[model samples]
Target chain A: MHPAPSVIIFTSFSGLGFGLLLFLGLGFPPVTGWVAFVFYAIAYALAVGGLLASAFHLGNPQRALKAFTQWKTSWLSREAWLSVMALLVMAVYAFCAVFLDTRLTVIGWIGAALSLLTVYSTSMIYGQLKTVPRWNQPLTPVHLLTLSIAGGALLAGQMTVAAALLALAAAVQVAHWQVGDGALKASGTNLATATGLGTPGSIRAFEPPHTGTNYLLKEFVHVVGRKHSRKLRMIALTLGYGLPVVLLIIPGAGHVLGLLAVISHVAGLVTSRWLFFAEAEHVVGLYYGKRSA
Target chain B: MTELPASTQKKLGLVIDLDTCVGCHACVISCKGWNTENYGAPLSDMDAYGADPSGTFLNRVHSYEITPAEGPAQLVHFPKSCLHCEDAPCVTVCPTGASYKRQEDGIVLVNESACIGCGLCAWACPYGARELDALEGVMKKCTLCVDRIYNENLPEEDRQPACVRTCPAGARHFGDLGDPDSDVSRLVAERGGMDLMPEQGTKPVNKYLPPRPKQDVSHDMDILAPFLEPVAEDPKGFLGWLDKALEKL
Candidate 1:
């Protein structure tokens, strides 16, 4: 809920990168030689860069290797394992596609599925948190996957396909906001419920636990104004979805237009991702008598 | 390793009485003092004694004002720490297997050596129990004072969490709640101890006793009328009689 910078960068770029890898693994754009090399390079850079950005947020980056071992329970662990598998598979597939100029259908298909699965695992890392009611929903994964695929399709230069996926992603984003905005209110948690003091009447915090900010306040009790959030959402809708859709779908929309669409979509997505964390209301805030929903 | 056991052998936890806590913060200070040295990493402080001071603390006391529709408002002091839940999401969400719930006593702990400090366990906890040590880059939380509780170094009577031992009001109790005959279990039954935010379904081991019902102490006029009798004047005069009458009133 902190809207941490490293996390925002990691989620945004990695989703797009993986989305592109999925398309490439499935043999989209049908290119070979230098053109294919450039695509693979961009995908790998984005994907790897995003992974490094994630590691940067860790307090002990050296210990991150241990994260791969807890896949049986932790979604973050699953994400680590899945992303590694997806990246490895994509690397081999890229080798065959660029060097041999022939896509191995089985390997290609496997890589594509793994790529998508990796993205899903990333989404699950947030979605599994019951403390943050805004993210604990089926729509979280839907939003992540749709946005990744749409962004991927755009970067892969598949204008027609990207347009349709962008539209779908936009719809999912809208629905996600519609549902997530009300999730905290729907959850039956309040200060009384949080403290197990359900009798008497409404509860209000008389004295905070500490005078200065603590880890909980910094990490879980973020507050974003409704007016600002509303304005950001409108900007996100216009740039992330609207402009990209109009630009990509217009007749005679050349490479310049496609690139512009990609830029606008990425910008819009950044805003959306910021909202994704800022708007999330952790249930722990109820203990402070903050908004429950 | 991150998965919780089917059941813990004993549910060792704290039972806090909200009715008696005086918000003295003795437990908070004692916990910080004992844990900062006892634990592997010190509970680091940033900008301490400055304009804005903050430090990692295992236990914290929060006060709340509860106003009933029919009566006056009451202030309640709440001391919070890890509940060591049976189905702890914090343990399950640990990516590096650093966070775990002890099978022997159901006491949740963090293996500091393995913690990557991604802070997921903190995010998963509803009580805001875990705090990331910014200096050490690791997550730390209340271990229920496993070191002190199991230590043979001190007197047997002192085998409890620093917070519980330091509580001045006797508001804190620690014991195995698994046994129905235990003192804690009886207290919970008698005092109607409750789980905080049960809907989260963590099945917390610790419990909180709600504040006692308030009583009205206003005197009725009719009951006091007979007691307000005026004294008769003696040779001293009206002043003496007036003093006696005022005292009676």
Candidate 2:
């Protein structure tokens, strides 16, 4: 719930990168020469840059290589392994498409599948957290997948596909927020249940453990005002999904509109991701008597 | 390695009595003082002496005011730490196998050497048991005083968690919860000890003894009339006059 900058960048940018790679691998909006090179550049930069940015969130970034070994049980490990596999497969696919002037459909399909799988694993990293009720739900993966696909479509200049996916993504995002708000409110635990004092009429925090902040408070106890959150949600909804939908509908073939849509969507997603982290209510907050999270 | 064993050899944990805890924070301080120099990294503080101080600790005590429907309000001191759950998500979620639950005893611990400190284990826990050391950039948590518990150098009586050993009110108990015959388990059985947030499905090893019902104090005593006869009718001496003047002032 700390909403560290590195993680936000990693999740959003890498999702867009993989989404674009998925389209390229499927040979959508087929292009070659300088155009292909530029597409590949954006895809590689986003995918690789996002991967590198993820390491910065770790306490010891140098030891990140160890993370690849525990894919059997850890979603973070799965994400690491899958992202690497996708990137490597995409590299081969890119070489065939750009240099050999051949699109090996089989390898391209494999690369595309892997790329999407990588995004799913990233979403699962947060989605699997049962401690944070707001995130541990079916909607989390839905939101992640739809947003990535929409962003990827826009980046690849597939206007009609982008417009449709953008609408779908916006709907999913709205649905996710609606469900999330209710889920947090309806969490089973409360101050009484948390402390096993349910027989008492009411439980109130008479005194905090300490006057000063501690690690748990700093990392998990983020409190955002409802008014402020509502305002930000409006801003995110407008910038992230609405503007892209509007730009693509203007009936223009200019590259500028497509680029603007991508930028606007990415910016909107940043705000959404921030809200995602900020609004998440960890169950541990119950120990401190935080009513909602 | 992060997968919990099918069954631990012994379920060693603490059972804290809520009624007797007294909210003194002695266990919290003792845990911090001993653990800071023992098995793991020192509990570090950021801006310790500044206007806003923050730090890491293995144990914390939360005080709550409980108002019952039929009685006066009472303050309950609730101390919390790692419950060493039977189905610990913290261990399974660890990407580097740094976080693990011991098979010999059901003690969840972190291997500092292997920890990348990504903090997924902390996120997996519902009890707020784990914390990250700001200075070392590694996760630190209650080892159940593993070093002290197993150390032969310590006196036989002192071979327990520092919190349990130092609690002035004897509210903290550490022993084998798996053995029904153990003092802690027997105490739990006697006191009707209960788990915290059983719905989370962690199946915590630790238990809490609930507070006893309050006595009806009002029924035992008579409402006597005024005992003192009005302070000798406002001053037989200079001292009395001064007392009345001070009260008025």
Candidate 3:
């Protein structure tokens, strides 16, 4: 996996943004007028900005509109459709709250569900990749969903709920890493099976196809050092999950402390998201003799 | 549109013989040459003659060393391209419906015009078969030379994949594998051909014929021992007098 900057930003920021929208749609912090406008503005910026960032990684962003057509079989297509629907519904819901000063509970509920579903769809884009064994697990969706809801709660200023959700997010994140560590080996794809040469005593890649690099090697054969990933994991856990929970639960914690918690959490989310791609071992790497997967 | 047809009329794919491939990479070069000129995209290269050169290649040959349980190590040349799987994951993962498997011939292809170049299809494939053209920003893959294979413009003998046509070793065979009576299918049956990564359950149409077991010749060294047996023992008769004089001196 490349750990592409555009994708890291997209996943992290968009997850947080949609998480906020989900909370607002559910009427958490129930503020109307300019206050509601500020919330909606921030939410849309994160969600839309993340999506735009995703487009940056595409080889042909011009044809991205066509991406909406294949939802029946493609999770990426489902994500595009779900994100659009979620954002559109949330916009209407936000407009009513900001201008009409009305709380349409049904519409708000629908928007909240759509927002959540949008995040789930995004997770599925990576989760459904059986080629990347580390991501092909039920925990992938669980990790992303928990992070979004927890981040949303924090943004909505629901300290008590945020604290609980953050704790749950931490658990899921740790479990995800635990399982992902051995996923490639567990998948049973290696040089032997990859080349159909297992009948021999043992097999090892002697030479690659070319002396020069190729798209597959560049994109799928990323090698993140163990020490670096371990350090990033610590930073991600401490700032993204641990610190937020502590800050939210601390007695007499005020606005300044809340702002610090949000900043810390966002920073942590970005780090963890980087690891998400960097650590993913695509099975295709076996052909290149890069890794076991 | 990304949904695969219930069944393809023919499972058209390659059967590569690992035993015969000399790892010369002739098919790889031929594939690149033909595809860049004939296919939808030119298979562009970045920094081609400079440092960090990279390019999109539909077919590639990788070499591997395998040690048998009882014999010496053997090198096998593995050429990989799109398997054109019965359950092609790349097709189903395309968000733009640009990637599809033909219901007629079972050739998986990317409609480059419709491609967003999101690269999800590349990620979905386990074989690393599909590559995104850096310059064109569209997916490039082995169409199995769809143009050449079906082109009425070419001579009947030339109407096959560029790699198949160019293979000097006769290692690459192309035909309908779905037809049990096809030449390729018969070759597969005789050679005990196998699929790559069957556990992934992609149900690949392509098959690989494993290298036959090697013969051990270490014990045959005894035949050469007689030639080295005292051919100059005690020197020649003329040199014997010189040896005696040297000993006296």
Candidate 4:
């Protein structure tokens, strides 16, 4: 399966959209929508950034708008349209709330609902993909929602329990990775089939089609350093997941620790996701002989 | 969103038996034939008979040799097509409303006019059902012969798919699988049918009943068994006398 940066963007970007709106809806002292404008600016910037990132994936980006028509069923359509709408709402709410009044409860609540809905929609998009069992769970929504909220709160410099939750989440994510890793290991170290090419087997090798890796091998198919794989997995699981959770409970460590936690979480997740991609042997790879027999 | 009609409708599907498929690629040829002529564009080849000849196709068959549990390892020709899943990943992954599942017949359709050619649906699908048509500059896939299936011009039975009608082996079948009483459904039920990739949870209406062998086989090659060395080559000279004694006994 193609590693959708949209799924990544949807999770990462929508956090800003939803996080800003959630605080506004809660009647927390109204920050000037100008400040909320920062959230909106970053939110939509990432939204557009995500859109552009996705644009790189297609053969043609000029024709991307034709996708907006089928929101009746397509989650991608919903995510795209709603994200744009969320940005518009954020902009509109910014202009009205900041320039006019921040006390407009109805508008804030509506904005909040839309933002959270956007995040939820983003989560559900990947969550519904049962083919990738790793991403197919309610935890995907919960994880992404928390991450976005954590991200926005961090960006907004709010060192509340959101940071604490981010820490716990980072911790849990490590554990989650291990659980998935173990499952994959038992199933021969991949989301698909087959484990590794070590010494001997009932089956043997074929000469590779390319001496240098091809595009599919480079982009879609990849293998990482196996020498220290077990150790790295442990490190990723521990420091990647554990360090952040413990940081949350530490007093006077909320903001900086939250920032560190978010950074670490992203870093760990990047590696973890990379591993996820690397570990997943595409059934196509079997035919190409790119994957080990 | 317009509310879908609640009237009784059928999710028509095709179940092509692998035991019978010859991997002739007739279905692929016919699918391209129909989509290109009817749809906006034909499947294009980047370099036909050249260094590369990549093109879009809604259906492609893969040949595999599967060793059945109780039979000889035989070549099982599998035709890969859109399962036309109830929860189509291609439909959900579309950023535009171009990819959609029909409420009436549960047909998964791609609206070319609305598609921006983002190719998100391509990534979302584990089955690689949909393909980008280079000539049309849009995504295309099997329509289940939607155009001909419902056409009033053709005879009642002639309206079905060209592939199904043309299949010389009678391996391909097209009917409403959603209705439990339909012929397709009955065939599936009696034969213990299965989805190609049920783990995806797309809930594809199309089914594939694993081939039942016409005969059985049982044997284990003992390649690892201990070898019997010639006693004459052995250094035990007493062994010759012992062998002679044992032979006489």
The reply for model 3, stretches above 4 Å from the true place, is A199-201, B228-230, B234-236, B242-249
Candidate 3, residue B100: CA error in Å?
A: 0.4
Angstrom error at residue A250, model 1: 1.2
Number of backbone collisions per candidate, in order? 2, 0, 0, 5
Worst 10 residues of 1 chain B by lDDT: B213-222
| Worst ten in a row by lDDT for model 1 chain A | A196-205
Q: Clashing residue pairs, candidate 4?
A: A67-B96, A67-B97, A68-B96, A69-B97, A70-B97
Per-residue lDDT of candidate 4, residues A103-142 (tens digit)? 5667667766777777777777766654445555456677
What is the iRMSD in Å for candidate 4? 6.9
Which one is best on lDDT?
3
Please provide, for model 2 over B162-194, each residue's C-alpha lDDT reduced to its tens digit, 9 standing for 90 to 100. 999999999999999999999999999999999
TM-score of 4: 0.69
lDDT of model 4, residue B185 = 88
Model 4 local distance difference test score: 0.61
* TM-score of the second chain of model 4 compared to its true counterpart: 0.80
Best-to-worst lDDT order: 3, 1, 2, 4
Q: Write the per-residue lDDT of candidate 2 for residues A42-88, one digit (tens) a residue.
A: 99999999989888877887788888777889999999999999999
After superposing candidate 2, which stretches have Cα over 4 Å from the reference?
A199-201, B219-249
* lDDT (Cα atoms) of all candidates against the true structure: 0.91, 0.88, 0.92, 0.61
State the lDDT at B121 in candidate 1: 96
Q: TM-score for each prediction?
A: 0.95, 0.94, 0.98, 0.69
Quote the positional error of residue A276 for candidate 3 in Å.
0.4
